[model samples]
Target chain A: MTIRYPNGKKYVPVRTSKSQKLKNPSFSNRGKSLEDELNESNDYYLSRGIAVIHKKPVPVQVVKVSYPARSAARITEAYFGTPSTTDYNGVWKGIYVDFEAKETKIKTSFPLNNIKEHQIQHMQNVTNAGGFAFLIIKFTTLERYFIVPFEMVERKWDRMKAGGRKSITLLEFENTSVEVQPGYIPRLDYLNAVETLMKLYDDKIER
Target chain B: MTIRYPNGKKYVPVRTSKSQKLKNPSFSNRGKSLEDELNESNDYYLSRGIAVIHKKPVPVQVVKVSYPARSAARITEAYFGTPSTTDYNGVWKGIYVDFEAKETKIKTSFPLNNIKEHQIQHMQNVTNAGGFAFLIIKFTTLERYFIVPFEMVERKWDRMKAGGRKSITLLEFENTSVEVQPGYIPRLDYLNAVETLMKLYDDKIER
Candidate 1:
């Protein structure tokens, strides 16, 4: 089944090789999507009282509905609505956490087009409010994940707007972004990186 | 038109009498529902950079969808899902804000059944994380609104669990909760009450 996004983009499923699955038979997220893994991570965080993050429901505009005499109301027609904000947001240790997760198959660079303009604006808003905002960049093919801070994103976005490089290089990611290793309970374990980000902010304040 | 909630409860729209509308002709929200007013207030806050709050979309589980030949994909089958968390939450002035808005025609007491068990749990999680959590209770018939802190609600909930009163009386509300007066730019200015709540917390820490 194919699910179309608000922009009419078809949701593509990431395929895992049989050999790769067999090689990592013990892991739970062998063939799972980034979104699914992140959700599982959130569940782990919630169950342990570590965080209260949640993914917002996909925005859909219901155009028509029919109520059967003895049954529940059935939605007859609906269209996906463009998201005005990022997917995940919640509080962690008295600090606000907001971030967007995007999986890219490209290994050399992470494209700027993966995030929308308004989404960047929303992240900027969160950061301006003293909240921690970042991007969870999942290199699906490379089996790597990095938590790219919004400040870095904003700088690149500004440069891109001025006709500079259209994407951030892997070298840049290695140098600036905090890498998160995949694990068992919390599939992604991105909060460790978040803690690092928080410390960086604290150090800046102290300075 | 009626929209059923995930629990199969039909959404009842607040009806405004013609005389009442005439009496409050100058107000933009004369015939508006509490949800509408709250959304407008959030918009006002967002535009002014005061805060970034948003009402989560109604949760719907899409069972089936059809991709038309030329037009957009249409959801042919879906069911409303019970909300796992409160309707609204966001960041405000470096603080995390979480809340649920509820309206009642009954002026004597605010029914406890309006909030669910998991929702209370969600608010408790927010408070435990050192985030701000509250309820925007609108007494439609009495034209009164209150910002009821989670602490007050928690006390009442525990009392109810032990076979005490299931509802909070208007007298109790007036004594404990912060009253929010309706206005033009922002229909219900509950953030001012939230500021008061933050001050209360600061004072407690200082003490």
Candidate 2:
């Protein structure tokens, strides 16, 4: 049986045998999207009084709406709008936290084009304004997750703009970014990585 | 001539004589909605590098979309979803800021029903997380704007839930909230009011 998502993409099922799943328990969450994983993790965080982060709703331009029924107003004509900000943002430990989540199947490098120019600009602005901004990138094929700080992203972005490598290699990620471990309760434990990054920056400033 | 909006509400044009406008210059922005005022103010704040605040886009649930052309994907069926969070949120001076903007035509009191239970919960959660949360309320009839801190709002909410008055009176707002004077550049100078509220709370904490 074949299934398709609303975006017209094929929904490929993760075919892991029971024995294989037992060996690789992380494969159990292979079918979930990056967004779903983040949302579930955010929910767990909120419930545990750890953090309060939320993913902003997808933007849409409504041209026409109809009062089909008294209770339900139906939107008839609309189009998606280009988002001006990052996907997820909120407060964590009295500090403003902002990040964009991206997942790529390629294990070699994550393409710079995966993030929009405005999003980079937004992250820079947030960071400049003394807020904590970072990128939560998932290399799906490698099952690796990393939280790259805005300063690192800015340096890479400047390099990309100045005709440097158009992608950040997996080796570069391993060296620069903090890798997140997958977990059961929160799924992707990215906040732990974030805390490590924060401490690393704090130590740098002290030095 | 009658102008009707997409929502079937009549667009009431503010009729002001040139002499009246010259005497009271703020009357020029009488017709602008509270949302328009805030968006313009946010843009001004962004450009001046004062703060990074943004109004979240209206939430919509798209049911069916058609690829009419190769470029433009048209949404044919959708519905407006009840927003889970407040309208405006961003970072200010490394502190997370979150607030809801509401305008009421009632002169006597701002109705408690204007706010949802979940919204109050969200604000409380943000405040508990050490982020600042508040409401920017405009009494349209009185042409008065005030920034009421989430603490005050929580007290009122509890009072209302415990069989007190169903609404907060204008007198109560005058006593407890910080009034915002509208300006030509930012339109509504609510951030100044927010800063005042912050200091006030800080002093209370010190005491």
Of the candidates shown, which would achieve the greatest TM-score relative to the real structure? Answer: 2
Worst 10 residues of 2 chain B by lDDT: B19-28
lDDT of 2: 0.85
Q: Model 2, residue A97: displacement in angstroms?
A: 0.2
TM-score of chain B of 2: 0.84
| CAPRI accuracy category, model 1 | acceptable
lDDT of 2 by residue, A1-207 (tens): 769999999997554476545333354565577898899999998998888999999999999999965669999999999999999999877778899999987879999999899999898788766688999998876777899988887888899999998999999889989998888898887888898998886432121
Give the range of the ten consecutive residues with the poorest summed lDDT in model 2 chain A.
A19-28
Candidate 1 residues B30-64, lDDT tens each?
Answer: 66788999999999988889889999988888999
Q: After superposition, how far is residue A132 of candidate 2 from its true place, in Å?
A: 0.3
Candidate 1 lDDT over A1-207, as tens digits, reads 889889999987543576665433344556688888999999999999988999999988998899999998888888888888999999887788899999887889999999899999999888776677989998877888999888898899999999999999999999988999898887888989978866764332121
Off by over 4 Å in 2: A1-26, A202-207, B1-26, B203-207
lDDT of 1 at B12: 72
